[model samples]
Target: MSRSRKVTLRAHPHGPTPGWAEVDTPPPAPDSTAAAFFDVDNTMMQGASIYWFARGLAARNYFTTGDLIRFAWQQLRFRVLATERSGDMSQAREVALAFIEGWRVEDVQRLAEEIFDELMAPRIWAGTRRIAQRHLDAGERVWLVSAAPVEIGRVIAARLGLTGAMGTVAEVVDGSYTGRLVGDLMHGPAKAEAIIQLAAVEGLDLSRCTAYSDSANDLPMLSTVGRGVAINPDAVLLREARQRGWEVRDFRSGRRAVKIAVPSTAAAGLVAGAVTAGLALHRRRQRVS
Candidate 1:
């Protein structure tokens, strides 16, 4: 005969766990924390965060009119580029990283906040925001996980009034970016890894936590949590959700749906081409060094 062991779950300070008892699980462990991890792109905001930040820089003249045109082109490809082959995501992201080479870290943080308020504020989806708020009201810790720079993610989390966030942390030297990543960008398996590390540090119970995202790229992360929710899912993610019987929420189906306004595809294509070149050049420099 097998003996059963009991486990305990810790409730969030906001209130008692909602429907937690419905599940046949022991009480939470002492000091255990339940959290909600959210994806930043299509999952939260209607579009990509980098694009809006670039647009904000253009409007502020940080990037000249001509520079803005090129950047927009790159962002377009960044948004629509499909990754069929292995390492494709990494190669594509290297483009954005090259763009930020030699920028001061503090400057980026300050600018992200300004840009987020002016441009990103209006793009937040109410349905997704409601989910985040519900978790917050329940006193559960909430975090924004994305491949966008960490500073940008933190700003978004603060604005949303959540606990905190985690994102891609770029390598910095002498107060400026080195154009090299400190670790893997927070995507796919990397996101799951990040959450696992967080759980160890925060004493979170993965089986009692929740994760939300829209891209199939985030499947690894969604699978890591006990409850996975799909918001405004892309075709790939929607299919996976159906197969897994995961909960789905779509905020973009109605005529009143609003997303962040971006530039033309042609403009974004130009920017993508430039970014491709920039990545090649940056790689060459690294080889030479």
Candidate 2:
């Protein structure tokens, strides 16, 4: 289940995005028995990888501007609220799965690889990455546990040279997606369950493992490990981490209070700008056609 791939970061070909860096660490020795689990959104990267993937699809005209707007709104809520509600999860599951209903497994995988290099790679938080690298340096297996499609998670893990990844599995038949999930989304308690199952298969001891996340939704996953680190935690997770004496690492520069308050408005503005541009581009294309 865990396999290591060598990753070497080169100069950014698509210009700069925030938090990009080149790691100079030597190769890991793989001496440790314990492993580390990392949450994807906000913890490993600055934003939702799935949203970025959707944006890429939208650019390729795979979906309409309206579809992108809806996804952008959901992603904004995800970033601002930082809490995973059942309704939100259900809606996200539907939206995420519906878009790729008939996509070939290989085609989606190829797009995911392109999306990672173009959008996801630049958004990676340098601080969180350094921590992941430290675990790699110590020779412990590292896996990205995400609610995103497993294909996206695997791309990220492979790009970062992690041991592997676990994510929501979208069912496929005859090499094409069926637009349905195999089980529940790999989120909240489901994340913990996946880790527990993986541990058993990989001969890992939960008592010696560590998990990192940004949301209180992952409290189940965090508690499942011996050491839990909250990376840029939301207000709820921050409070919980303090009470539980879990390690907290905040890489954001602003005052803690500002971090919580600003995301809603800031992210909303970003989505609005994107929608405006998308609409304008759509209109132009329509006029030309």
Candidate 3:
């Protein structure tokens, strides 16, 4: 089983507003056997949630501008290029874990709550939020499945009035972050494994469930469910969705919906390389000091 943690839904202290408004349409009868799983980045939201969180922390002076730039570049690559290689995933995990090492879990959760409202809330896709709300209206459980830290995922899920969330587990010891993951990242094939275990525990029928995502990296997860939706999918996922007859939703405008051309991608790659070198130099200077 993947080391994804399942968080139970709870009311937020600030009483978060739902992304979608209340509809006059009557809700359907409860469907206890079915559920909907949604991916976070580029699916339910406009960009990477973690990148926003990192930006928020940067605003609070938690890290240097160089660190935030590195994060931003990584998110850009992930969002536009759909780069999800094993090495990239490993590097992201290490950077995130190291940054939070020795921090209190509760403190991180509190900051995540604030950051979600300030940064994440505005970025949520209205169309995707409506789809999730539709599942809720039908009395089916809705869960955000993400590779983000479980605490961050839970905040998003709770704020959106979803059932809960399944996300990557970061180990904690004595109420503080250990800077180590409990298992692997809750991504790619691991996401499929996590939900399979969750279904067994929650009595959900796999065939009755639906999964939504924006990346081809989630092929395992999208394939596991009965219905697969591609929301603002990358070129690879878009092609696969067309070939597989999966439902596709594009909230972006015609100009924005076009795939990033090779020139833009190559330029972004060059910028990322520069930012990465700067971040490395910054880290080296800190160590030297």
Candidate 1 Cα outliers beyond 4 Å, as residue runs: 1-31, 68-82, 88-93, 255-289
Measured against the true structure, the TM-scores of the candidates, in listed sequence, are 0.75, 0.74, 0.75
lDDT, candidate 1, residue 237? 90
Local lDDT at 135 for model 2? 90
Q: Can you give the lDDT of residue 129 in candidate 2?
A: 94
Clashing residue pairs for model 3? none
**Model 3 CA deviation exceeding 4 Å by range:** 1-28, 67-93, 254-289
lDDT value for model 1: 0.76
lDDT of 1 by residue, 152-252 (tens): 89999999898888988888999998777777878789999999999999989998899999888899999999999999887789999999999999888
Scored by lDDT, model 2 comes in at 0.78
The 0-to-1 C-alpha lDDT of every candidate, in the order given, reads 0.76, 0.78, 0.78
Candidate 2 structure quality by residue, lDDT tens digits, 214-289:
9888999999999999998888999999999999998776674354334323553344335434544554666799
The per-residue C-alpha lDDT of model 3 at residue 57 equals 66
Q: Rank the candidates by lDDT, best first.
A: 2, 3, 1
On the 0 to 100 scale, the lDDT of residue 192 in model 3 is 95
Report the C-alpha displacement of residue 246, candidate 1, in angstroms.
0.8
